[model samples]
Target: MKLPLHERIRSEIETAILSGTLRPGARLPTEHELMQRYDCSRMTVNKALSALAVAGLVDRNKRAGSSVAQPKVHSMVLDIPDLEQEVVRRGQRYRFQLSGREVKQPDPDYPEELQLAGNSDLLRLEGVHFADDRPLACERRLISLAAVPDIAAQMFDKISPGAWLLEHVPWTEAETRIAAVAADRTIAARLELPIGSACLSIERRTWRGADGITLVHQHFVGTAYDLVARFGPAKGSTGAEPQQL
Candidate 1:
């Protein structure tokens, strides 16, 4: 099966944006120019750009033409089931570069950062996550060893810890906090990004059953990634506004 022409074109543009060749607010070529460049009809160019616009990659307007939108801060409130299904449907080859694992007591070095107690049984793991061969994210996770025993024997080489646990264990709930942060030296090196680059940091905790706290995951996202949501009213329309905090 081959990719549709328009999808291929859209992917090309997306790659350019991720690689920083198409900076924020940079105007994309006109339909005529794209037709010439891709050797396709106006319909093909229009379809390609339209798909990009729908995906929040570009802003297209009759008067303003088409240009890259400034990258948005993402808030992905994903239903876990849907995310798992989507990943399976994509049939993408995945890989993980396991950094290391440590057994230690928790610390309060970054209090504002996920606040785990200092005396808690901590098992820390670090790695770079990949989709196919592309570096997707730098992951640093801390698991409560007392909560999930035998975690040290589990190998994350063939599957992500998150996905693996989701399949093998039953989780009741998860809480997450997302924020923007600048990449540090270690992350920059791992993600092949420049130092001080903007990245999204997500902290999450998952609970198993009623009393078991399973894991804590921290994801550092690179450019071209976003968390999206479908918005609607919480109840009947009134003076209330959408709450984001």
Candidate 2:
């Protein structure tokens, strides 16, 4: 299906802002530039920019033109965590050991595995994070090849996938889910814990605009690990968005 011209323009700009290419308060392209780029009428470009203003993603000024808007709220927020930083910040040494790596389609035979990039082929990885030479977390991740082609060449031997991605990728949005669960046999052996020991399980997904980037699951020994983050409120968050926990 063909997208409307104004929608396409809006999506392109939104993707830039979300991916950090267009930071807050950055000047947007002039109407003349947009018209020349998209080969559209001024009205079409104006419609697209107006939609962005309404959504609070941009601020329009008659004299200064349009610029990316400031965040809408100041409430506390939690963010996707980097396990290596978590350990190193506590004055412990950190290392990652890769157990498996493959390029495969989404959805394997194992129901326990998850890949949320729809039909995109994924760079699947499995590894363990060690803090001061003790197993700290077991990680299973799927990177969307469509979204980050450069990742396929990474050797991940000297770094964890999460850390590498944090440095190299720009993500628009992310979702995290937390659960307390009994360690399954696979995770128990990997983390060197008795089966059924309590563990903290976190599953996170990140994206660049509409294209999915990566989904990862990290499991930690509940007695030994903690996840923490500091953040400001999400842009345009309101009573409409989910409450912060």
Which one wins on TM-score?
Answer: 2
Every candidate's lDDT: 0.62, 0.78
Q: Compared with the true structure, what per-residue lDDT tens digits does model 2 show for residues 109-211?
A: 7432344545567899999988788888898888888667778889988878888887766565677788999999999999999999999988888865456
Q: Candidate 1's error at 156, in angstroms?
A: 1.4
Report RMSD for candidate 2: 8.1
How does residue 44 of candidate 1 score in lDDT? 90
Count: clashes, candidate 1 = 1
lDDT of 1 by residue, 88-122 (tens): 34564457778888776766575522344223567
Position 23, candidate 2: lDDT? 89
Error of 1 at 12 (Å): 47
